[model samples]
Target: MATNQQLTTIKCLILDHFITFNELSSIISYTPDLRRLHFSHRHERDTTIGSMSSIGLTNLTYLSLRIFSLNFHDFEIFIGKIQSKLITLSVNISPNDITYLDAYRWERLILQHLSQLERFSFQYPDSVDNEHRYFEGLNQFCSPFWIKRQWIFDVKIVDEGIVYVIHPYKKRCMSSIALTNLTYLSLRIFSLNFHDFEIFIGKIHSKLITLSVNISSNDITYLDAYRWERLILQHLPQLERFSFQYLDHVDNEHRYFEGLNQFCSPFWIKRRWIFDVKIVDEGIVYVVHPYK
Candidate 1:
């Protein structure tokens, strides 16, 4: 099971273990406020999916699935059952299923249910050594539907095999896009590495005035004010307002308080931003907000 008690207040989750589609629905029944979810789906074994009732996740906007084993038919049912206004959806498939590679199915699904989607990525962890058999004449994504959305179909030859990735077309680099003239930014990426964030901020540094970052981390580096101070000094010269919200599920990390002390230094004091901590349900939430 996931947990004994009902999780009523949790808004985001990244499950470490694999869960079947039905079990996932059961868990979602408890948390109505869930917005972002990342989980490993056990495709080979789905328990009690027959008893799975209609689930409503009205607030959910972001979803990432790492599909393990193999079951495309079950997944189609699961996807159809998911009722939400999804803004971003990503699926990484292992033990490739050709059903998922069908561009026509995706276009239909998106038009039917995911019309609100702004970004979508499909990754096939390819194993077809003979790329000709798999990728030959697979140009169904060239229709006006995909062209209007600017979602390009890209096939790359890597160590993994002939991998086809469907992603939003970008004019600049994927991670290091330069937004030099942008003034305000809010980042909610769950997998954004801390250092990569530093590089992203550097590019937008000159014109940025307001920044808000929400990150879930078990790493103590997130609480280090010195690191943030260095970043603010070196890159965010124009920044006038800043907020950092850190979340973690660690129960016994004693170093949190020690690392939090760094934020009390003169740099923060002079800026009139105060940091506070809260324990919610089963996780620790630390927030830095403008002193009022």
Candidate 2:
């Protein structure tokens, strides 16, 4: 049995599917003191909430919505109606959502209204075409803010732009963001090269304490165990924790395993951090190392 008295003190609401405006409003109406709301939905042409009658979630401090169909106007209106108390906001691509051919316009449009956002996660899946389209859109979208002195304190791009931009030159281009204030970063598809990886670590080494990189170690044909350790310990000096997903096809599994243990030694490790190493082929293996 339901009672009206049980509704007033609700603080958080999370929904897995898209809800109509009326349905969202009814939920909001039932909880006057709601503080957090998270929504994740896919495939369907979902609606973005905006200018609701119950826009009085005074205690609201966090809001995250991940819907497949979000445009500039939708974001503009949605952000306008959000209560100022929000401190954390995140959105990710739905697992089964079909992506548009190009997200350049979409990314440009959405980021224009994100000046006040604190945390962001944007993903476009893993495919050659999608990689090109996602970063082309992302690079252009962020170009305007490149010279601006604001920091994306926490940012994540998962399996989105790695395949298209996989060289030292591209890494230098990416470092233009000058993530001076960035403290947390997680990347899923950094291409398979040690030089490019070195430049990347050098670019953000100072500010980042947490890092995750997943790439095929098979591409590192010349990167014997020694070169790998030198690159990380020398350039990524501040990295307290390090994680690598080796994807080599060579039969030298024993050598790679020995190298892994050597590199994760405490002598070269810096800071106190969390590490997660995940390797995938026909089967997947995940190893976690944390500094205590």
Q: Which prediction has the highest TM-score against the true structure?
A: 1
Instruction: Write the residue-wise lDDT of candidate 2 on 124-226 in tens digits.
Output: 3444444233433444434444324222222234454332211111214654346666666666654546666666666663566666666644454322445
lDDT of 2 at 113: 39
Error in Å for residue 249 of model 2: 12
Q: Can you give the lDDT of residue 185 in candidate 2?
A: 64
Q: Give the range of the ten consecutive residues with the poorest summed lDDT in model 2.
A: 162-171
C-alpha lDDT (0 to 100) for residue 267 of candidate 1: 93
Q: Which ten residues in a row have the lowest lDDT in candidate 1?
A: 128-137
Summarize candidate 1's per-residue lDDT along 1-292 as a digit string, tens digits: 3354755878998887888877788778888889999999875646555567767789999999898765676666676678889999998888556777777888888888788999988887676564435565468888898889888888888876677788989864545456777888887858666777777777653578888989865555677789899999998877788998888775745547657788899999998889999888867888888888
**All candidates' lDDT scores?**
0.79, 0.51
Off by over 4 Å in 1: 1-7, 130-132, 173-292
Question: How displaced is residue 187 in candidate 2, in Å?
Answer: 24
